[model samples]
Target: MTTVPRRFEILLVAGFTESDETPPTSAHALRSAVVEATGETGESGYPRYAGNGMEADIDPATRTVEALLVDGAEIDYGLSVRVVAAPAT
Candidate 1:
């Protein structure tokens, strides 16, 4: 990989936590290409820091993205928000 700083691919992760307490087991993993591209178009490019968390329960089998999780809480379809890379630190 190139050692270019601030130049890396972000990832979008989600989880299903209705019963478990320790951590989530089932999850959705997706490349953050869409978020990166949109950020570029919006003039706010990659390496963004959302401060809070952004995630969604994306089901490939059902072709659905729902149950957004932000700041450790379940919310509605919140994909129309800024999605950044990493743990925001």
Candidate 2:
């Protein structure tokens, strides 16, 4: 049997709590997750600092991602995310 290639779209976020306060919408947050998932983090530097943190841990099977969000203080908040594949064009 021939193999069929599947295309998937994924999104990850720190969490809905912090995101709701941000100017962007949930959809935007989701898209950001996809961007983060695809980005690469090199050695600690200007380039790596500029990238999103959520992309660091993206799960292909569950299509999930995890990240930490920092509030005004040094304390970090965690976000567990799940991504649903987008429909084919």
Q: Identify the leading candidate in terms of TM-score.
A: 2
Expressed as tens digits, the lDDT of each residue in 1-89 for candidate 1 is 53213322224444334474542111334324221111211122222322225434332233233334456575444223222332333
Q: Residue-wise lDDT of candidate 2 within 1-89, one digit each (tens)?
A: 64212333344445555455543334765434223333443332111111333323334444433432222122234643444554445
Show pairs that collide, candidate 1: none
Q: Listing every candidate in turn, what is its Cα RMSD in Å to the true structure after a full C-alpha superposition? A: 12.8, 9.3
Which pairs clash (backbone N, Cα, C closer than 3 Å) in model 2? 14-79
Model 1 spans > 4 angstroms off: 1-52, 76-89
lDDT (CA) for every model shown? 0.32, 0.36
Question: What lDDT is obtained when candidate 2 is compared to the true structure?
Answer: 0.36
> Candidate 1 local accuracy as lDDT?
0.32
TM-score of each: 0.23, 0.30
